[model samples]
Target chain A: MYSRDEFFLLIEDLSLLPAISPSCRSAFDKMEDPEASLIGIGHLIEEDPGLASRLIKVANSPFYPYSGKVGSVREALVRLGLETTRGVILTTSLFDRIRGEAGVYALWQHSLAVSMISRNIAGHLRMPYPDEVALAGLLHDIGKIPYFMHDASEMHRSISDVDPGRPDYKREKEAFGMDHMEIGEHLTISWRFPSIVCAPIRWHHNPAKSPEADRTVVRIVALGDLIASAYGLGHPEFPFVDGDILQLTEELNLLGAEVTSLLTDFLYDRDLIVQRSHDVF
Target chain B: MARMMKVELATTEDGEMIVQDVHDMLGRLLVRAPRRIDPELKRMLLARGIQEVFIPDQSSGDAEYERQIVEQERDAIRKRFSRLQDTPDNKRIVEIFIRAFEVFHAEKGKIPPV
Candidate 1:
């Protein structure tokens, strides 16, 4: 059994590790400023030419809804909005950190799929902050990254043995002495992300247990995770849909017909979405 | 001219015709008939995680007809769920799916008809 202090130390070690580049970090920090203009945010991104170029690529990529190509960082920022821009920046940075690791790319692909699906579900339901939920979906499994960094093979083995029919959280806890949700929540909290985002990361596997106020968003992310898994987008270890998915959908007031249509849409779009994920990541 | 093709059962909607016996992943025969597909069968297929089944392919001369059928099904499904669309939560989900679909089409060309 791992002590709580061990988990805290893991977080501390992760904090000390070289994760995001300084320029990306600065760009993220600047995004928090209400007074920060698009140009200012653009310039901060420009400091890291690679990130700027990738941001433009993503902005023009099939992910964003816009038609025309975004030619510059400023245009990308204006098109993507602050929250999605932050998500893009963080995703790119995190991808850089774990680019070549076995299974990491696949995990990122899964995360991106979940992010897109979460945003879709939230927007369809007219949630107040869909992008925040998207961000949560993107980072929900982030706690696994530290474990991969520590021992990729061990982490891979642990997840590979998980029973597909059950939620992987308990297995994760048993294997690593801390589940990904706990580690993810702690990390996101330390990153200063709002509770709206952090709570979903912590409770996405079991949305009914989340605080009543945050339940909707948490359920959306949870559904997104399930859909992404169902579509075979990312990590294969936890591919089975949780039995509670239908119940959660009902609680969120999504109609059976809506769920059917959504599943149809996903079925038709799965290959292309998987392809887009590979291209983006 | 029509031929038979193995397709994922989950992708088959109600009214489609199955051409052979459907079996679960464990090889247990679930449905044995050249039967017209229905919602209950689809649900049972999905429940067992059965990935593929043989189906009659009438997509030859009636490609337009097939497309129309798919569109109608999609439309009916949408209308049924339309009441939820006005809410912020459902709206965001629809917007995201549309955006993702648009992007996929733009980047990879149109997805071929299933």
Candidate 2:
């Protein structure tokens, strides 16, 4: 097994993936700056016509409450808010960069399911930043992308193996000396993602280990992941097992009645949400 | 004393008290139940593009909706999860998933499988 430092070296030496584009990274940094204006952020996003159009579509989606049609990037930026707009730009840019890689479509579909479910749970609980949670879910499993890009024989022997009784991460840890969560955490940190986005990526599988401030959102992602897997929208090899649902509810401190109510809402909207997930890409 | 019935929001009649909470497509609560169906509530639901809500009905019985929803999904879920160990947690999960599916469909209109 390779040491953690060696893993990083291998990733860099083999060119497993490229860093975030300089232009997108600069725009993201500007959005984070307190001195940045809405017009200024708009101008930066407008420089790339493709991103600008995608931002408008995301703004007009039913996720946001604005009734009027969004015509301009500036207006879309205002509608999405800075944090959520930043999340959108980051996720979409990453998704764009990884497009056409083998097995990316299935992976995207699973992420979309988790993203939609997580957002629904966030809204049902009246949590803040539901859209940001959606983006977090979308990017949670992104550490697996490098495996997909690795040599075909290695990818098949490691990631594609179906370990029926164990969690997916344990197998990944055995094979690569790091689980997907750890890999994901490292990648997001290198990309300079905020804690809100990175915490779920790292802690979703074991939410109790997350900091108190981020525990609830991490629990939401865990539940969303379980539910998605239960409904056959899960990752083929690493699906969360049966007891995970109960464990997560306990971690969230949800009483039996509350769990029942929350799950009823999830069941009610499952099909509609699943249908909407397909529209993401 | 009457059974609850799921009705399209646009067609709900006057004086029909909602028997359960009304939620939108995303599962956010709109109005808590045991409340009267007012024009204002209807307007709000319409504004939000909601299509249905559970209202008290004199014609059909309450048991049918729950039974139907559970029956439609129970076997399929059990088959899908057959590989899981037959523990209490797994059984409860299957039950909760199917039961919640029943409750939600009984409250709101059901979406048939595609």
Candidate 1 per-residue lDDT, tens place, A1-281, comes to 34556656866766543588889888878988889888888888898888898888888876565788889999988888887787677657766766665456667777877777777778778888877887888888888787776666666666555354545677667666788898888877777778888899999878878988888888888888876754445354544444355566788798765775565555554655655755566
Which candidate number has the best DockQ? 2
Candidate 2: misplaced stretches above 4 Å? A1-3, A10-19, A63-67, A150-153, A156-159, A239-243, A255-257, A267-269, A273-278, B1-76, B79-85, B104-114
Model 1 ranges off by over 4 Å = A1-4, A162-166, B1-114
Q: Per-residue lDDT tens digits of candidate 2, residues A184-268?
A: 8777776667788889999988888898888888988988887776654565444334437887877667767777687665564
- Return the top candidate by TM-score: 2
DockQ of the candidate models in sequence: 0.04, 0.12
- Score residue A82 of candidate 1 by CA lDDT: 84
The CAPRI category of model 2 is incorrect
In angstroms, the error of model 1 at B16 is 28
Q: For each candidate, give its TM-score against the true structure.
A: 0.69, 0.70
Checking candidate 2 for backbone clashes, the offending pairs are none
